[model samples]
Target: MVEQTIIGIDVSRDWLDGFCLPEKQRFRFQNSPDGYARLLEILQGMPDDLKVGFEATGGQEWALWRILISMGINTVQLPPAQIKAFALSMGKRARTDQIDAELIARFMAFRPEAGRALPDEKLQRLRALTVRRAQMVDARKRLSAQISACRKQGVSAELEDMDSILKAFIETQISELEQRIEGVIAQATELSAKAELLRSILGIGPVSVAILLAEMPELGRMTATEAAAMPGLAPMAHDSGAMHGKRVISGGRRSLRHVLFQAGLAAACHNPVLKAVARRMKERGKPHKLVIVAIARRLITIANAVIKTGLPWRISSAA
Candidate 1:
């Protein structure tokens, strides 16, 4: 592969700033198709191929990414936190839009693989919807807390009425979102089929399936342990040299972790395999809740296996 020009894109709501090296070409555009066309026109003259990189800013960056990807231009989407950390380590006196763009460009130039670009329009849409739903769910929780406190303290009638209204509204909105999520899944043949496969496994359901489709489309793409680690459920050693300690899990996708914990709860109640695991753990004197978490992790392992091998779950009563 010929070495190409490295370009960093600083993206915002209505405009984007691009910086390139060697010739030091910099330009600002309207962040529209017309603007993207202009930017591409400038990039077409590079000596080698073109490598474009940018940081993730939720859905704000999605349009530009889609546009670039469709144009057959190689694009790299860096995690925002990773880029921010890179900036901190650079030891720059002060930061500007240009500085951040330069950092992204530098990272892309050195560690080209740090920029991972997934070419999935449907998956991208699902991810956006699922992430937004998570945010809404969190907001609903906060609002519910406020309403609960108002009722507990026997606040004014008007306050109670407002709280009730808000709670109802949030619930309605959540229901609508849930229905739309199912619709989105049903519309995508591959995703819908995969989701159905996921649901066939014990402890996995519509919501969990939706999340798995969005956050981890790579379940079957790797080993069970690898997938579990991505969701932050893989067990890790917590020992200190000579000091013996338990294995604990750390640093994974919080949403996936949450879904697994909830699914584990349901699985422990009904999934024969997980129930057996929970029983064995309890026999070993494990804490009740901790055993449930263990069951969740095991369920995750099984789920990964099912997705990978395209096999239905078989609960062996002999076990």
Candidate 2:
């Protein structure tokens, strides 16, 4: 039998800090095409059991990840925070690329599921388009705010020429991005069906569907509680002995949590089934904001169930 080998690489824009566990070997490579080629050259005949893991360094690790995965390598892009916590747990405080790389290896050796597989290329494109759209939308809003400020200060004309064209350009870009997102999803049969199913629910529109498809590809595969916790909608307990402390929501992906808030709020008001869930929570003296979160949880839970079962949402009294 072949021994299992796990390698961890701490990714930076300029260099890759690597450590191969069990073998206890350390190496460094440039963060470039040449570097990637050199790294692959070193591992040309590795066994099928070989696994490589790295922390998600924003967009920096994307190219290498795609390359390795394309070559049928087992790779995971881990959450940096978890790696940091793992280092602290081991009482390793001095931070360096080499140390981080070792910690990532140890972390993966300790918990194989600590990292996630990257989504498919079409999902990646959807995320890229949506992220750019969000940036453009935010820029347009800022420009509009500046125009309003100028009007208040009696100098509105100063931005008249620039703001109009910039805002128009931003809107046009946003529309084009939306079209691209739709096109990408339409080209993927699984995503197209999922999007149709998601949009069939009340209070979930194209933007919400796009977000779920892009960010939560594991939507139907996980449990309801897991799905809710993915977006930080799950209430975390704060109990010690008999203290029985208050429950609060925290952690998880912030963008997913944010997009759900609006959908949750809208569902709490507009979706009759979800609105009833909110009403019950409210009648029990739950704060309106708390009720909204609960309704959002319900909304996503139903979404998960429906997606997993390949069915559509229906009014249900059970919360």
Candidate 3:
């Protein structure tokens, strides 16, 4: 049997700190084209069963990740939270780039299936557009709030004018981003089909479809429970021995979770099947928030079933 060589990297804007297990080798390279070439050269000398892993450091690790995958290297993006938990489990106290690199490598060795592979190029582009759109929307929201406050306080006319101009610019940018996102999805046959299926569900708008396809690409391939869990909508139990604790959710894609909550609000009121589910839960005296969460979970579950079966959401099948 052949052994696997696992390499973990601590990525930053300017540098890549890496540690290799089994060989116990450490290396550092600049985060540049030249650095990528040097790292590729080193990787070429390794075993055929090589696995490279790194924490998702925002956009900093993207270039390196793309280059490595393009070169046929198996790369995975580890969640930062998982790495932190792994560090604590190992009884590690001090923190440094090199130490982090080692911890990531060790974590990879401990759990070989722990990270996410890169989505395809088109999905990547869609993810970028949706993220930018969200940022613009957030900026516009904040600016609008300030503008309202200023009106109440009777702020200077010049300040109000500037605020209005900034708000208009942000809205324009958001519109452009949405157009780009739609274009990206429409151009891809698979994505377009998936979008159509997702949109068949009432209360799931274009924005919701774009986010689900971009952030949770594993949608159709996962079980209904996995679908709910991926967006942190699944209720987690906290029972031990004789003491039962409240069920709560934690740790999933935050962006996906936020959008689902928004979708859930609409689903609870409008989605036929889901609205009934919400009504029953409400009649049972469930909290408003819990009812919404249940609706969100059902929404994703229906989405998963729809996509998996390659059928539009029908009232009979979805239920």
Candidate 4:
């Protein structure tokens, strides 16, 4: 039997620090095209079951990750939160690039299933658009708040004019991004079908569907419970011995969870099936937040079922 080889990398804007386990090799290289070539040469010589792991350092690691994947290297993009928790567990206090690389490698070795493989190129592009659109939307929201504050303070006309112009530009950019997202989905038959199915669900708008498709690509393939859990809608239990503590949810894709919460609020008010679910929970004296969480879980389950069956949501089927 062949043992698996794990290589963890700490990526920064200007350098790539790496540590290989079992062999305990440490290396550093410039984060550039030539550096990628050199790194590929070394990786190509490693064992067949080589697993390269790295933290998702904003977008700094993307170029190297893409290159490694293109060269047929098995790469995994890990969440920084998980790595930090692992560091805490190990009582590691000091921090350095080399130390981080070793920690990532060891974490991969400890939990081989941690992190995610790269999504396809089209999904990647869609995700990028959605993320950028979200950023711009947030900026517009903050600016609107500031504009309101300025109006209350009786700010200058010139400042108000500038705010209006900037706000218009941000809205235009958001619209363009939405168009690009739509184009990306429409260009692929599978994505189009999935989008259609997702849209058939009550209260799931275009943005929600795009986010689900982009962020949670495993929608159709996962179980209903798995689908709920992916967005952090599934309740987690805190129990010991004969005592059961309150069930709460934590950890999953945070962005998807936020979108689902918004979708849940909409569904609770407008979606017939989910509205009934929310009513029942509310009547049972469940808190407003808990009711929303329940609706969100139900929404995801319905979505998973709709996608899995390749059928549009019908009252009978969804109920």
Candidate 5:
């Protein structure tokens, strides 16, 4: 009887460390086309029905996973925390590419049904643009603060020149980021359409929409509760011996959470559907901010529904 194989690759900038289980064999390959070719050859030598898993380390999985998927090989991209937790559970506290590969192999062995992640190239590009845009926004804030400090400290000619140059650079980068995002929208009509639907919800705009389309592509694929929980919007349930703790939202895509929080504030004021919901919750003495969060979760649900069904936002009239 032939043994089923489990494989894991710890991808990095210059090289990748791969582990093959049942045999506990390891292979090192360069992070390039030739390296990928070697990987394919190695996998080809194994049984036809092999399962492979890897972690998402700074978009490292893209090149190799794309190659594997193109050649009809199955690959699962494990979340970073999930892989770490799995290692801790097995009493392996040390961290290394080799240990990560071993842990991933163990994870694959137990959870064979882990979902295959086939990321969209266009969405990836959008994600890059949005992240760059965020950096520019941060730079702008820092530069503005520095400029204010310079003025308060009696800036000299050199300080004035430096502050002006920094401010200009931040603005230029912000403008460039905006242009790149516009180009992404122009190229990806389907993505733009889904993004536009998200924008129709009063508070969401081009930037937020782009982030959602790129970071949370599974937004429409899962249920509302699932989507909320996926992004840590769904609160954790807490129970103890004669003690109860407040359920708190945690982890999963901090960038998305930030955008939703901003959008929720607007939705609470101007979005009729969300505004009404917030008003009703407020009447019941719920905290305004918490209600906004509830509205944000609902907005995510509506956005998911719109993308899933390819339908536009529709507001129903009250009787």
Candidate 6:
């Protein structure tokens, strides 16, 4: 196992700041094709044992990530928060893109399994569609709320009409997006099969399936707790030296968690299996919110089991 070159990049719209460890070199390049080419040139001379790292700066890193992955260069997309935390732990109070790039490289060196490998091309497409759907859903919710307010306040007829038109448009857009999502799933055999398996569970609909398939790509790769934690659904205990504290959920894919929570609501009402789990928790005097979280976690567990086994869900009567 030869020592690898760990390179970190802080990507921006117009520029990229990079730091390469083991070689201790830094490069600043334009965020353009020319810059991408130069970065590749540098990698060409580096050891074959190379690991590139960068933060997931929204979509800014996507181009670079794809480029590196396509070039057969190892790349990892580190979470910004985790890297920030790592910086503070290192007692590096000051910050800059250059510093961040360096920290990312070091973090990768410290934690090799800190980020995900590039996902399948279909998974990437699913993610884009699902994310857009989430945005559309949120917009729809806001517009609905505004429409309700207009009705309550008896707003002018023209204003009400405009609101209605906008609402209808958003709804239509959402419907189209739903169809596209379905098509994307059908285009891939693995995705289509897994989606069919997921939908076999009561209350897991198309939207839920899209979000899970896109955001939870590691669905069949880990244990139930690992799956739950990826979406921040796991109950994290806070206890020390007999000084117990409340358990709270934190630090996972927020979008995944949001979509799962929505599904949990439906599953709690319609899925006999999950309803039983929720009922038991409620009977144990747990709050409604906690019960919902438990249901979400259980939903993830069942989904994980289904995908791992390549089987559709059988409506379980026993808890």
Q: Residue-wise lDDT of candidate 6 within 1-319, one digit each (tens)?
A: 2267889999988998999887789999999999999989999888888998888776788888999999889888888778888999999999998998999989998888899777888888788787788789899999889889889998999998898899899999999989999999999999999999999988788888998998888898899889989989888999999899999998888887887888889999999888888888899999998888788888888899889989788875232
Give each model's whole-structure lDDT. Answer: 0.79, 0.85, 0.90, 0.90, 0.80, 0.87
- lDDT for 65 (candidate 4): 83
- For model 3, how many clashes? 0
Residue 196 Cα positional deviation in candidate 3, in Å, after optimal superposition: 0.3
TM-score list, all predictions: 0.81, 0.89, 0.94, 0.94, 0.84, 0.91
Q: Write the per-residue lDDT of candidate 5 for residues 1-319, one digit (tens) a residue.
A: 2166989889989888888888999988999999998889988888778888898775767878888888888787877777777788889999888888888887888777764477778877887788778888988898888888879999898988988998888898888888888788778878777776776666677777878877888877888788887656787878798889887777666788888888888888888878888899999999877887787777777787777777677666220
Q: Which ten residues in a row have the lowest lDDT in candidate 4?
A: 310-319
Q: Could you give the C-alpha RMSD of every candidate to the true structure, in order shown? A: 3.7, 2.7, 1.9, 1.9, 3.2, 2.4
Clashing pairs in 2: none
Order of candidate numbers by lDDT, starting with the best: 4, 3, 6, 2, 5, 1
- lDDT (tens digit, per residue) of candidate 3 on 187-213: 999999999999999878999999999
Report backbone clashes per prediction.
Answer: 0, 0, 0, 0, 0, 0
Q: Rate residue 28 of model 5 by lDDT.
A: 89
lDDT of 2 by residue, 168-260 (tens): 988899999999999999999999999988887887778888888888888899999999998889999999998999999987766677778
**Total backbone collisions, model 4:** 0
lDDT per residue for candidate 1 within 13-61, as digits (tens), equals 7888888864467778987889878987876766447888888776777
User: Considering summed lDDT, which 10 consecutive residues are worst modelled in model 5?
Assistant: 310-319
lDDT of 6 at 96: 91
Instruction: Pick the winner on TM-score between candidates 1 and 4.
Output: 4
Model 1 stretches with alpha carbons more than 4 Å out = 1-4, 14-38, 84-97, 115-119, 235-248, 282-294, 317-319
